[model samples]
Target: MNLEDLRAVRSRERSSDSLQDLRASFYEEVADYIQERKDARERAAAEADDPFSSEEVQTLTDEIETAEQVAEAIYERRMGKLVKQASLAAAGMTGDTDGLTNEERRLYEDLVARIEENKSHVLDVLAGEVEPGAEATGDDDAEPDPIDAAHANPEPGELSEPADDAVAPPDSARDESSAAAAMGGGLDGAEEPAAVDDAAVSTSRASDEEGDEAGAERTTVRITRDVGDVLGVDERQYSLEAEDVVVLPEENAKPLVEKDAAEEL
Candidate 1:
């Protein structure tokens, strides 16, 4: 393409949200145009009586620089749009793909595959259908608990009887138990306080569990733009990008939602 055509392509790309149509040989044409200009510039310089003041050579050099810059801008803008399109397709909402070059189409397909695969694995982990890091090792076998194994398969000659020392209480222990029962008015009186203590402990445990659940509060969101790295309220770092679906602590997610950077999912 010519310098004017490159500028026009860059203008269209900047002005439009969607990708503009381009020929299959667009990149090859640009390369050819730049090479032709370079050759012309060299010939002009060589033929000029005063090479330092060659107007044709200077004009060709400027055109080459501008064309390169415009082409790069057009490519970058199109690439960003393609990435977003691929993300949408991965989420099952296919969008327009009317003007993609063969190379771009391949890139789009690869992006979709990678995004879909990663999303599926994350969802599987959240759904409890897969364990984190389980895929890496391909090992699902769990080690047997030593206590459970011993109980499930005891040795044939293992003794089931109690030792001689466990047969009866010593006289001093019996006397102390009898004294405590008498002082408490009965065994029931002494055991009532222990029963209340057990109930108090149970109640405390329940309260602690409730507090833990509250502390772990999270919000699910869909990112609309690249947020890079964010330090979460849970003291962990999160790397977020456009079209990413993730769960963040409610406090950390609040700012992004309010800023319209992410929407609650």
Candidate 2:
């Protein structure tokens, strides 16, 4: 199709209901027109007694190629405009919404959904960073520690189930205030030793988990046919096809795997 013809088709199909149909029809026309040219060439060659004539067809493949090129160029221009409009909507640009038609809104929502779907990778999934899901899991699964977990329900200065080897102190010698202050607290108060131990252990485990998440090496994966486009990983890009491998964090690859788009290496 010529430039004017393509524009005519697009203008007529700009409505939401006809947009998909328009794309399908454009591709079909390009394919059919190219095939028609080839068929005409073969027929013309056969008509001549000497099929291999020195005369070349002035429009040999040019019209078909041009048609294809024009179609793609139109698609790219439209796609660029739509992407910009969608971005402006996402950024909450006022007055930019003036001309957003129903068709454009649909396209805008789709683009927004795609960005949200990949948000984990865009923000948190990266080299030396923990999985985005991990952070979510950490938040969801974490339980608040009880204030009296260490020593529950104890009387003031009363030793917790006196140790086996402990000797009984003279009643007068065991002043409750001095003893409670010494142990940092009695049954009624938090045990300093127990609280300290718990805090230290919790801190240590948190540090270890942070280290594991940060030091985790990149994993490799292969894209299956389900992933019909090329994707960018941390430092490279991988085409979407079977047997194509890419290295990335598990969080970044989760959607692909869930979609049957890739398998872990």
Candidate 3:
């Protein structure tokens, strides 16, 4: 072979070898990097407050590896196509032929752009980032709640039971009050006997129910009303997500929404 032909052959051979090495080395490097990440994740889990056991780690790692492999496959295919095109162009452009036809120039530019784009995607995937425009979707076929689906109830469900008041006296106070009212009105108070009797019955019933639930068994937490008043309106307006707060107080210091009549105009 002539000097130019020998040079061309050597160049093609080197390109082929380089491409082969890249193909193998890419996966090996990616595998090692992924393994290192897995090891780090396992160590983190072990040190976490709620540690993942070996079995849990194994399961999660399996899932993660499987997903990563799928992503790598897509990256590999895209990269392989681009590399093949680039290698073919390199092989064709053997001599120092800088001056080219319009079609050839366009093809070379397109090939270069494709190579760059695909190579970047492969590197991104290997580095544990997702490819552009790839989205994962799942089934959205679950049935809705009957009450919610119906929309019959405009309001949310019944309010949870209120927390007990700490400063307020127990059921005994109501009992004393009832006794005093009964004694004060017993045939010697204002209005007719029937009206007096009805009022006493109503009061007694209310006192009995209140006594049943409002005994010393109730536990209460207290906060100052003025402290609640000092809270910014913006803070009051924002609702907390379940994950945002460590613990929700049994009783809210302020009502969820202030009533127009409840607040002074």
Candidate 4:
């Protein structure tokens, strides 16, 4: 990769780093909470003759008070959230029945699956267990991964910062220009161009013109497989892991068939 490529990669890595950093804070809080919960459970088990307390009793209440104080001292701004998270974990582990609605349960399950997939991907990346990209094959119809769509084809100005010297003109100047332009007046008394010269600039654009990358464009060949091809099941029963798939976009491609009924209307 050249300098531009390197810069692009660094930008991606920096974005990835920021995401990881945000998660790291939560991980730290989780770790500390888990440790404190374990220590309290251990201490409690050793203390009372009847270690199993009543259903009304709160486990590790004393330890939590101390943990809250310590957490506040360490992370003053985040103490509330951290303490609440730790409390929830402790409560969940101790069989304290916190209610989860049906929707919440479904969402939680989805989050768990994503977490698992991310874990596997991270390990695979670290261990060099997978190909850098997908393995090339003669087979057509292999769709690109949806997860890469956001990061794959970055647009111009997607990550650019404005120049330091940029400034806005006064509102009064902006209003005056707007008012003058609306009152059948031209800026700086500009005149209409001569008729002969105007014809040169009035060119018609072809309806089917290709975008900027006409010659060097990547082809996104559609991949179609019978249900039995990969799944070994009927086409109707072919459950898919959409997350594992890579999908490349077809340039200048329009959908042939409308998937949504509303679109037909």
Specify the highest-TM-score model's number: 1
Off by over 4 Å in 4: 1-98, 131-265
Model 4 clash count equals 10
Tens-place lDDT digits, model 1, residues 176-205: 454323222100100011112444445545
TM-score of 4: 0.18
Candidate 2 ranges beyond 4 A from true positions: 1-24, 49-58, 88-110, 119-265
What lDDT tens digits, residue by residue, belong to model 4 across residues 1-265?
1223322322342233111112324334535775766676777667666667722124565445444433322222222233333344443433111333243334445544454555566666677975556443323486766655544755776753445657888975675444323222110111132223222222201211231234322222112210010211111111111111211212211120121100110
Q: Extract clashing residue pairs from model 2.
A: 154-187
lDDT of 4: 0.33
Candidate 3: C-alpha RMSD to true structure equals 33.6
lDDT of 1 at 252: 62
Model 1 scores worst on lDDT over the 10 consecutive residues at 185-194
In angstroms, give how far residue 232 of model 4 lies from its true place. Answer: 50
**Whole-structure CA lDDT of model 2:** 0.47
TM-scores of the candidates are: 0.49, 0.31, 0.19, 0.18
Badly placed stretches (over 4 Å) of model 1 are 133-265
Instruction: State the RMSD for candidate 4.
Output: 30.5
lDDT agreement with native, every candidate: 0.67, 0.47, 0.37, 0.33
Candidate 3 vs candidate 4, lDDT winner: 3
